[model samples]
Target: MTQYTQKVNETTLKMPVALLQVGMFVCRLDRPWLGTPFLMQGFLIDNRETLQSVRALCSHVFVDPNKSLIQLRSPRERRRSRRETPEPPTLSPTVDRDMARLGLREVLPTYTRTLKGVKQALREVGRGHPLNPERLAGQVDECINALIDNIPAMTWLSRVKSHDDYTYEHAMHVSLLCMVFGIHCGWPRHEVRQAGLAGLLFDLGKLRIPKALLGKPTPLAETEWQLFREHPKWTRYLLEKSGFEQDVVMACYYHHERPDGRGYPVRKLGTQVPLAARLIHILDAFDAMISYRPYAQQRTVYEAIRVLYHGRNSQFDAALVDQFIELMGVYPMGTLVELSSGEVAVVIGQNHDARLLPKVAIIRDRNKNPVAEHVVNLKQLRDAEGKARFRVKSMLLDGSYGVYMQEYTRHLVLDASPA
Candidate 1:
């Protein structure tokens, strides 16, 4: 695939024809000047008159370097020369009517409530009688479906009140992240739901540990470590007591197991670890790396992903690592990046074919001046030769830019406008 750079609003004009828009983001333009096509290295700063004139002459206006002004043939001519063509889908009134029958907004709150209930159930697990494992599973299934259906529309995390309930909240976040990976992998709906449930409950073992140990900022001593090793077994007992399916209980018990047999508990290796368990292990590690612990600051998503990628064969399953990389992109969600053009933006989504050139929304310039209200689709713009205009030179952590991602996430979801 073609590699492109990201640019901000800054544009550099190359004499008469070329315009180069460079910053944290970059775009190049080569268009005809006077009578011949010219190449520029910037955004269109003075094309209002030219754009209007070209629009009058053709249905679509494209820049040409060799010619000053060329009249292109109509769409009919292009259609006639096609080697192969797929027919456009026919839209019917019945299809539109059927779509109208679906109620989307009615489902969002229901799913959100279900997530809350799942968290409650997980929290209640070892406190008294065992919680309902089947109900928790059902809640997870609902949340996954809701998330998949809303992914395209969800530009940022929702503004729910911050809960001191760490275990349940963390479980929910991990499940959501795993679901994102699952969607990227094109997993079937059923499989994705199962993965989400596994992710949510992967840390059930932690609940069996003493509250003091769970909250400790210091490293565990030998005796404490010995107790830590048994948490998985305790977790399995808890699940079995709650009447969970064997597979679900195993998924929770073995989530920490590694492919290299280097992980905790049984130290099972490779195929001995179930697929659900393996995926949960990777997701669990990723969530831990990016999340703040009492002893350490959180790492950026990009940094955590890099650590995971580098440790693929040893620390994680190689194939699952590759799939996760593809799922999250080079700059995963919550990553702050500086573009080659010198503008800074947060990566909100992945561009699969262009890992290095995912879509970014510009927020700051080279001088760190705020330009908070802009959104740029880096994949849509091209150069004079119809080539991608910008490239991503490096990825930066949000902390380096004086941005706290969790705080930012809070503001993004709560504030009505982009800040």
Candidate 2:
């Protein structure tokens, strides 16, 4: 039997290969199979024999306590390997510039087009086409990249508008929201992308359901609700049939499953549900809350956030929920607010200095006239002795002002004067 030293929770354990079980914790081997080495978390350690079995499965294993260091037995071989394979260049500056450019490139047009594509894809699926996973994946990536690069400037709350195509628009919105939530949960870029894809396709199974039922403005009947609950299973089936990977399929199927076992099709609780699924669930609900459905009135972002916070532990992960609140701030981009100064403005950007005092563009005053616009960096400006003079009193929705968010956002970003 080959002896190996494994690190678990910062403590090193010396054991033979045969003693490992499903739940037995193990740090990454000195050499990983692929990509970044990951520490195993919460796996099932069924029996000692299982541990030995895993050892048999691998030909060679090396132990390393440090996650970043690779231990090569032969210094000569290591030197040769390093000479042949140089490390990839660092990407911080490049990534930052790329992200900024992506944000500024007029993505709304592309977003509108992608929305149409999603609707079209759904229609094709409804008509029994093979549920084109490749096409759907491409669309998912596009939507995610767009949203991540542009999370609405801190000031433009009312301007964050939904498109006319409800189905596709809803998909894009959910994808964006899920991306934000995933970032809050400290998910890596790949996981965040997966979460976005999952959110975009979370309701893909709805294509299999009857259009009449899906479009019903009335409350679902008991039987209809049962059918609705089975959508996740249908989603899993579709994903499997389309050859989607397991992680992607699980995320798509389990986004509706609550953490407390009250969710449908699986009733999985706590860690039973994948992290990707849980992240998507929180974001999916957030998007739905801000959305105006055919039968339900839209909730303001603040109100929607409150609902999410209230559902912590029961419906969502509490830490993730808190992080999400911090990520979006109390007043997110595109939110309209009434300031204490008797002025109405749209939140445009977050002030790096004081999160509470975001930059705003005044759109109306006490008399409610369309006036000359100027950017107000709330962090820099203050009252008499340098105290905050303005405070947000209320958040308003686009419908309340008889404006569409998409149009309003364009005007705000393009026409508003810089402060």
Q: Give TM per candidate.
A: 0.67, 0.69
Q: Tell me how far the alpha carbon of residue 112 in candidate 2 is from the true structure, in angstroms, after superposition.
A: 3.5
Candidate 1's residue-wise lDDT over 1-419, tens digit each?
A: 11222222233212212221111111233343435233443223234444433323322223222232323223344356443665433223334222212322334454457658866776587566687767777776776666667653221332121325546656766777667777777888777777777777677777778989877789889999899888788878877887877777787888878878998798999878877788888877776766656655666667778888888877788899888776655665446778778887766546544466666666688776777535454654566554557656667654556655456554444443323
C-alpha displacement of 38 in model 1, angstroms? 33
Best by TM-score: 2
Evaluate model 1: give its lDDT. 0.60
lDDT tens digits by residue: candidate 2, 1-419: 23333333343443333333345444434345454223352123355454454555543333332331323123345457769997444223334333323343446655666667777877777777766667767766775565565555311221355545566666767776776666656678778777767777778888778878887889999999999888888888877887877898998787888878998777889778888788778877887778777767788888889999999999998877888788788777667777778787776667543567876767677666666655576665654444567777788876654545566655534533344
C-alpha displacement of 389 in model 2, angstroms?
A: 1.7
